[model samples]
Target: MSQDRDEASAGPQPAEPERGGGAATSSGPTDDDGALAPGAIPEDEVAPRSKSRWAFARELTVIVVIALVLSFLVKTFLAQPFFIPSASMESTLDIGDRIIVSKFTPQHSPLHRGDIVVFEDPKTWGSVPQHRSLLKRVVNDSLVFVGILPGGGDHVVKRIIGMPGDHVVCSLACSTKAGPLTVNGVPITEPYIDKGSVPSTTPFNITVPADKVWVMGDNRNDSADSRFHDGTSHGKLGSVPMSDITGQVVAIAWPISRIHAMKDYSNVFAKVPKP
Candidate 1:
């Protein structure tokens, strides 16, 4: 009776829980405070972070590729950027000025007489070929191809003075004593010509042929334009083929102070009758 009373005082022993199937396993290694230890995250948890990083990288790549393609398409068919390398079109487009040319003008829109055009070198036009290291050329070409850099060297920009079938004439002694440039027998007043410059120092009379145009620069005295190339060795290299035109200068794109839409001077050519 005493022993039974003592056992009752000691209280009953606790039952042992079953192992294996019913056992509770820890999710991962833990520190003293029961928080997951550094680098002790489960493989499944870590995999998601890795996958997210890869996904981000892939998405960025896709976006960059898409942007490049759009830029190329815009440059190819919509518009392109160019920088003035010389003073040929100065006062209007100074050296180091950047401009945007619209391909739509040549492709879809009717080109007007006063339009400023960009075209390939019709007869080399006295442009000296630049010598560049192969690596430099590759880098520059790639940038130009992608529309990230403005095109230069192989193209020239000038104002169209005579379109197809126009009888253009610049009178004798093309110096300070030069005569007014007449188109279709009408003298056109040009207010865009550079200060202290004459119409031209070289005189010529030529009727622009079909699918060709006579172009001149705003800086008349400094420009070696259609007049200089009028009677080249290649014969009448002054007239640029319409097919060679890349586009028309639509706006000045750089030199924030000079940012403005290009003027076509339609009124200047308004009175000149079409041939």
Candidate 2:
């Protein structure tokens, strides 16, 4: 019996389990499954996250506005879109081709012969027939003013054939084969013109007036250019004033398959004497 009592008191036998099936732990912030309790987020961190999001949005808005303003300014002063509307330019430029005309080049340098140029239609020249209604016209013009569209009313594109004081003449019988088109007593070979198209169908002889330029389309048969207005006043109809020039077309940008630089014909006109 004394031995049994010694074994019973040996180091403190395992304590009886708590009243529950398993031993209970000290109470604290925990679920029955032992997951931690949710704590309140700091007010400082919450406000900063919200403010940061708003700040990012504001910065994005500022950047977008700046980009649009820069684009408008560049289109207005440096270069702008130009679209070919008719077949007058033919093999050189096709209808629906988009081009970029450089306003800066014409501003700094004198206009040269053989340069494809965009100009304002002279008052006496016939207006390009527009099939749109009045409302459509107004909307189109508004878009152009805001730098959205390429061209507006009263704008025409042609190749420069004569400058001030140039004496230009063409065959009376519609024959480029018969050595047509002479400028300042020098014959001009226009390889840009379409095959089978004569230099001119009607007779014409004119000396470009002072401070003016004579322009013609490559598709001579279809073009109503300086050749059509020969019977009118010297400076008023047959020639465009230097101030009327908008820009020189440097490149065709649209229709990815047809992308190309508008070639300058300086070599073709090299032998012609300046008038």
Candidate 3:
């Protein structure tokens, strides 16, 4: 009876369920190390993680492209930056100063006397083009085109003193000690002229043609402006064509200590009748 009980107890033991079906039973899925197997890690999980990284990079690239496009548009139409290259504007705008110009004038806004403006060099204006190496020129042109750099040495800046059909005259005897400049036969006070400078030393009398404007610099004596080009071979080049005007200088943007809104001296020309 004792021997029979031992035999029954040791029988079979269910063969331990053949231990995971057999070594050749497809062995299940395994990790990189062939240790963990799948389920501890999902089959679809790693692919999504890789896709998420790719998605983030794509999104970032799209945002950057949009930002660049907006910047280009703003610079081309609304406003632009320009740097002062000479002392032509003196106290109002100095050499090396950077300024922001608004495109609204003569478009969305009316230009007025005493309004500072930037315009294309009217050829006879005697502006000297800056010389630079080919590589440097390319680099600068690119930056300016993208609105990342201020334009300089190519355009001119001055204040508008006469509009279409206004009779502008400066007497030959006019000196720093002499009193005023006449516009439309009315003597006008110019508070913006350089302290020791006169309205004009070289006299001129002309009716500004239609669609043209007479411009001058604040540093009158030092500036080769309308007065110098009044009767040049270029024929009435003194008066810049309205189309040549780029924009109205709205503010000084550089040299933090010099940052300020540009002032329009409307009251100075208020008493003068329109011509």
Candidate 4:
């Protein structure tokens, strides 16, 4: 009975766990507070992505601006699009034909007698009515300045017949005769003229003045060219100042069926000695 009482007093001793709970908790994912631990990221790895995007945008803007400037300069000083507004050029250049004119040609070389050229209309040529709205006008003028569109109003295209200081004469007889249209007493065969059209129905003889050129159209019968404007209000009707010449027609650029380079008329004037 004494031994039983002593064993009862030492009863209810603590027991050892079957699994290692402390080690399991220490090896788990989170800290003791149940919060996630943050990973270390290097300062170099967190680069400025927004800055890179902004830089790209700035570079694109610069490229677009440069492209626009280059286009404008080319149109203003090198070449431009010119639309044929009349049938004066006929088979060579019909109405609606878009041609490229090289402003550089007139600057580098003197205007030759057989070259086709575009020129600003003389004061006596009068003005065409403006049928466009303000918005349309602004848009068209802007596009034309950049060589994206053709010019409108007060511009004409013609072939040079007499250069500075050359004597030019015409006759209705030119349709049948080879020498009716003469420059400095030398005849020019114009095969480009519309068939059956006379060179000039109204005869006139004049010496082209210094710094001026006499011009005419290929479709002589239907054209109101230097011959038609003779003795007009400007007095210098048959001649346009070299300063008024814009550029030489180099090629037809639009309308897929009519795309071709401008004809070289060097052979046409080859026999004529320089004055």
Higher-ranked by TM-score: 2 or 3: 3
Write down the lDDT that model 1 would get: 0.85
**What TM-score does candidate 1 reach?**
0.81
Global lDDT of each model? 0.85, 0.80, 0.82, 0.78
Model 2: per-residue lDDT, tens digit, 1-275?
A: 99999998889668564565332343334468855334423334445677889999999999977876776787778888878888888988889999888887578878888999998888667666668899989988766765678884578889999988898877664353577688898989899997678888776778898888999999988887887875746434779888888888999999999898888799988999877
Question: Per-residue lDDT of 129-181 in model 3, one digit per residue for the tens?
Answer: 78899999999998888778898767899999898888887786564447577
Over the full model, what C-alpha lDDT does candidate 4 score relative to the true structure?
A: 0.78
Q: Write the per-residue lDDT of candidate 4 for residues 214-257, one digit (tens) a residue.
A: 88898888787887776743226668888888899999998999
Worst 10 residues of 2 by lDDT: 21-30
RMSD of each: 7.8, 9.6, 7.5, 9.9
Q: What's the TM for model 2?
A: 0.76
TM-score to native of every candidate shown:
0.81, 0.76, 0.79, 0.75
Scored against the true structure, residue 260 in model 4 reaches a CA lDDT of 96
Question: In candidate 1, what are the lDDT values of residues 1-275, reduced to their tens digit?
Answer: 99998988996789675555433343575567766544355545556777899999999999999999999999999999999999989899999999999999888998998899999887535557789999999999898888989998888999999999899887875455456888999987788989888888776788888888899999998987787777743215788888989999999989999999997699999999879
lDDT of 2: 0.80
Clashing pairs in 3: none
**Which scores higher on lDDT, 2 or 4?**
2
> Which is better, 3 or 4, measured by lDDT?
3
Clashes of 1: 0
Which candidate number would show the highest TM-score if scored against the true structure?
1
